[model samples]
Target: MTVDSGIQWRVGDALEPITLPPVTRLELIQYAGASGDFNPIHTIDAEAEKAGLPGVIAHGMLTMAKISRLFSPYLKYGWVRDFYTRFVGKVFVDDVIMIGASVAEKEEKGAETVYWFEVIAQNRKEEHVAVGELTFLV
Candidate 1:
């Protein structure tokens, strides 16, 4: 909570969790148009079946974007330097996403402080869909 100070970051502090509503085809379609990533597997059911998916699956980046929301409240105190993720599971239609991050480490870099966070996204079943590291420079 004390982000403006020179140094008082707790290495194991947990950010608030954000739970997003279930994924829907409409949202996926919209994301496709907006991102110009009209990948059929993310929208068309038939295409998803053709691609060996149970149904239209959510775009991996879409889930990544959800993970980024965990940093919104901290943006004013720092800028995101890097975000890395590994897609461990597929996101399907109607799957609710829960994103969370915990402070993994903190350090002072002369004038700026750096924070490393362990970020993760899980489905309603508590299965990990994404795991990653986030670097913030303050």
Candidate 2:
């Protein structure tokens, strides 16, 4: 989708899908350190096993960040008024995730235009990891 200054906005405009690199144990550890969320389920395989998880999982925020990156181009022109998501499934180490977004609605609100978007993230198995919405004012 083309995003230009003074461009027209339309419903159903979709951002290109962003395919993330395979999640790794090291990355989980780093995210845990950076976010101060050292939950064993996210960083330690043994602990995850004890918790009945198949393996170390990626942090929910980390997954959200990857998904939110799809909006970087839009954010340059508009401000995100609200962003939210529901964590629907686990994202484990080595999972390849893809983020996608489509404009669901657009309306003129006084001087500014408001855009509503549907954002979804899925793993290689086509399982939704997160489902969300984002609202932007441009």
Candidate 3:
């Protein structure tokens, strides 16, 4: 949702996991078109392979967007102050990924409540493709 939403989250709340549909070159291209991150490694298979990747790969931002989708539904009306992430592995077309997150900690910073979050995206092989932390203002 929008940033001005109210706080309904708690320290131990768990978000329902989301399984991303199989990734595809078409999907990556669509995201590139939408986000304007037209990295050759994401759209050109040969370039990606020549760079030592298996094939054309999904954008890290695109994967992060999927992670964001998983968070938005549970956090409800949101106030995400900061999101920090790292791409641990490349995700290729046809890989099935699941996104999950849980509350890692909580703190009261004067008038704001900050929920520390841990997020992970795992492929069908159960490999962590991306790991992230998010801080939300409640």
TM-score of each: 0.93, 0.92, 0.85
Please list the residue runs of candidate 2 whose C-alpha ends up more than 4 Å from where it truly belongs after superposition.
1-7
State how far residue 6 of model 1 sits from its true place (Å).
9.3
lDDT of 2 by residue, 11-64 (tens): 998888999989999999898999999889998889999999988888889988
Q: TM-score of model 3 relative to the true fold?
A: 0.85
Model 1, 25-58: lDDT tens digits are 9999999998999989999999999999889998
Clashing residue pairs in candidate 1, if any? none
**lDDT tens digits, residue span 1-138, model 3:** 576655555767778888877988789999999999988899998899899988898998988889888656446554778888899988999999999888989988797677888999999889999998987776
lDDT for model 3: 0.84
Q: How many residue pairs clash in each candidate at the backbone level?
A: 0, 0, 0
Instruction: Give the Cα error of residue 64 in candidate 1, in Å.
Output: 0.6
Give the per-residue Cα lDDT of candidate 2 at 138.
87
Give the top-scoring candidate (TM-score).
1
The lowest-lDDT stretch of 10 consecutive residues in candidate 1 is 1-10
TM-score of 1: 0.93
